[model samples]
Target: MVSRGCCPAKIGELTLWWKGPLWLHKEDADWPKKKNIYCQADEALLEARTVSHVLSTVKYDLSIVEKYSSLLKLLRVIALCRRFMHNASKKERLSGALQAGEIDKAESSIIRLVQASSFTSEIQDLCKSSQVSPKSVLLRLRPFLDKNNLIRVSGRLGNASTLNESQQHPIILPAKGVFTKLIFIYWHDNLMHGGQQAVLSAVRQKYWPLNGRNIARHVVHRCVKCFKYRPAVVKPIMGDLPEARVRPAQAFKKTGVDFAGPFIIKSSLRRNALLNKAYACLFFALLLKQGT
Candidate 1:
C-alpha cells in the first residue's frame, strides 16, 4: 500500500494514466484517464480480484450503472456479486443495478429475493448502529423508489398509467334510465292544469334535472305511453276560490232575466202608430227615462 493524496490505497504499478475520483469516468478523457501501465498501490486489489478490479472489467455491471448517480458506489457491490455469480450456470446481476419499471416482473421478483438475501446482514447492522430503522424492503418494492447510493426507482419500467387514471375518477355513477310509469302519470293529470296541459304543466312544474339535460328531457320522459295510462294525476286538495263582488244597483248582472209582458205606448207621428215597449237591463243594469 502507498499514500495517494489522502487515501492510503493499494496500487500495482503507476500506469502512465490516471484513476480519477468516482465522479470522473473514462469517458472524461481529461478526468484522469489511464491505460494499463505501472502502479504498485493497486496490487492488493489486483491480487484480491476485489470490487475495484472487477468494476473495471465486469461487462454486465458496466452495462447498467450510469456514471452520474449516487448509486455509483453500489457498482462495486454489483461487481462483487457478478464475480460470485459468474461461476453459476445462471448469470445473475446484483440488486444494486436493479431497475424498477425497466425490469420484467418475473426477473424483478427474483432480483428482489436475491437482494433481500444478500443485504440482510448489512441492513440489520446498519439499523443497529444508526439507532434507526432501515427502509422496509417490501415497501421499497413499490414500483417507484430511490435509495441513496444504492438503488433508484427512476430506472423502473412498467405500466402504471392505468392504475393512476382509475384513482383519479373513482365514483362514476350509472346512467338514469326512464322514470317509472307511476311518476309519469302523476305528472300528466292534475286539475289545476288543463287536460294534457295540466300533465305537461305539472311535469314542467315538478321536473328534476338529470345529467345536466333539463326540461327537454323532463317533457320527453313524462310523455311516455305506459306512464300516460298509469292514472290521471289528481289535483292536490286546495280550498275553493273566493266569490266575486257584485254592485247592489246592478240587478240580474250575474243572472240573466226574461220579460213576462210588454206595455203599449202611442207614437206621436200618427194616431194609427202603436209601439210596444218594455224596459230590460242589457249586459249590465240600465234604466231608461223614456218620458223625455
Candidate 2:
C-alpha cells in the first residue's frame, strides 16, 4: 500500500480536483451611461396658462365719457354758480354791516382794508381805495392778503360776538415789524413767557395773524428766561493722560505694585500640625514697541 503522505503536495498544483470545466461568459458590455436631462416645458406652459387666464379676466374702461356726461356737467355748473352767488351775497351783506356801526371802527377799518387789498392789483391802489397810509398794518400785510384771500368779514372776529372781551378780540398783523413785536410781547408777557405752545395758544385766542406760530417760536427762542432755564445736554471733556503714562520710558522705570494674598500653609502633613501664613506681591511695568 502507498504511504498516505507520499503524494500529499506538489508545487503549483491544485490539491482539489473538478469533475467538469467551469462555466464562464463575459457580460455584455454595459451600454454607455445616459445623462439625466431636465426639461422646463411644463413650467413654461403653466406660466403661459396663468397669463392667459389673467388677460381674459381683466376689464378696462377706455371710454372718455359715459351716458350722463351732459347731465353731470349741468349739475356741476349749477353747484358752482350757487356757491358763487352765496359767497357774493355774503360778502355784500358783510361789507354793508362793516361799514355800518355794527363793528368797532378800528376792527372794521382793518377788515375793509384787508378785503380791499385782497381784490386790488397794487398796494398803492389798496392804500388809495381804503384810505390807509403806507405805515398802516394792512399795508404791511399786502403780501399775506394777496396769498390767502382770507377776508371773510361775515364771520365774527375770533368768533366773538362783541369786541370788548380781550380774549375774543381778533387782530390781523404782519409777520414782522413793530406790530408783530408788540403783539408777541403782549401775549408772551400775558402768558408769563410760558413756552412756544402756551404763547401760541394765547395769541390765537385773540389774534388771527399769518404765520403766527413762526412769530411765537421766534419770540420764544429769543426769550432770555427760556434760554437760561431750558434743559440742555452737556458733553464731558476727556482729560489728558499723566506724564508718566504718556511719555516714553524704560520697562519697570515707573511700575505699579500690588499685594495678592496671605494664604494659610500647613507646617506638617499631620492634621494637628501648626499652620503658617504666606503672601504674594505683584509689579506691572509699561512697555513700548514699534508696532504697538
Candidate 3:
C-alpha cells in the first residue's frame, strides 16, 4: 500500500486495463473462445460484393431508347425515366412512384429479381415488423447513460445493424470474436480472469467509464510475478473438494535382504542362556517379490 495506490509487490504490477475489476464482468470474463459467426464480416463483405457486382453489371445495359425492347428493358426505360425525371428534360418527365409508392409493383421496371423477391413473404414481413425507431429509444436511453457507457442500435428495413460486441449486454449477447486464452476466474474472488483482457491490455492502461484507483487493483493482480505469488484465499465458495482432478491407482512389489541387529529385552521365542549379552544380531532375507 502506498500514497498513490496499492502496490502488492516490489516493482508493482503494470496497469493493463483501465476499466478494471468492476469492468471485470464485461471486459475480461465474457469473451468467448470459438470463432463467432458475426466475425465473418458478412455484412461488410456482402456490401462490397453488391457494390462490385452493380458496378460491373451497370456497363452492360442496352439502355438506348429503340423500338426493340425486352419486357424487362421496356420496364427499365420507364422506371429510369421516372427515377431521373426530376433531372430529365420536361417532356421526358415520368412518375416517381418507384420509391414512395406503397405498392411493391412500382419497382417492377428496374430488375427482374426485385419483382420476384417482392413475393417472398419473409421480406414483406420484415418491412412491416420494424416498428421500433432508433430515435425513440436512443433519446430516452441517452439521459440514463453516463460517460462510461453508450447504447446504439440502427437497423433500416433492408440494412444490417451496428452493435459493439466489446461491451456485453445482459440480455442481448453479441457474438464473441476471436480471443487469446480462456481462463475461468471465479467471479467472487475475481481470480483467474483471462482471454480478451490479455488482448486489450496491450492497447490501453486505463479505459473510460471508471475511476483511477480501481484499475490498479486489477492490473497488479494479473502481473506474472504478482499472480504467481498472490496468496491463495481458500475461503468458502470453493466447495468441499477441488473435484476437477483425477488419477489412477497402481501396485508395487519389492524384495531385499536386511540385517537386524539390536540390543533389547529377550524375545519370548529366545530361551537363550545369553540373555544378558551386550547386543543381539539376526539376519532375515527376502527370496522373491511379485504383484498379482
Best candidate, lDDT: 2
For candidate 1, the lDDT comes to 0.36
Cα-based lDDT at residue 286, candidate 3: 28
Model 2, span 220-272: residue lDDT tens: 89877877888687989989766767688886677766786789989889999
Q: Which ranges of candidate 3 are over 4 A from the true structure?
A: 1-192, 195-209, 212-226, 229-292
Better of 1 and 2 by lDDT: 2
Q: Which is the better candidate, 1 or 3, if ranked by lDDT?
A: 1
Residue 29 CA displacement from its true place in model 1, Å: 75
What is the lDDT for 100 in model 1?
43
lDDT of 2: 0.49
TM-score-better candidate, 1 vs 2 = 2
| Pairwise lDDT winner, candidates 2 and 3 | 2
Per-prediction TM-score, please? Answer: 0.13, 0.29, 0.13
How do all the candidates rank in terms of lDDT, highest first?
2, 1, 3
Instruction: Give lDDT tens digits, candidate 1, residues 102-125.
Output: 233322333334333434443344
Backbone clashes (count) for model 2: 0
Which parts of model 2 have CA positions greater than 4 angstroms off? 1-169, 237-292
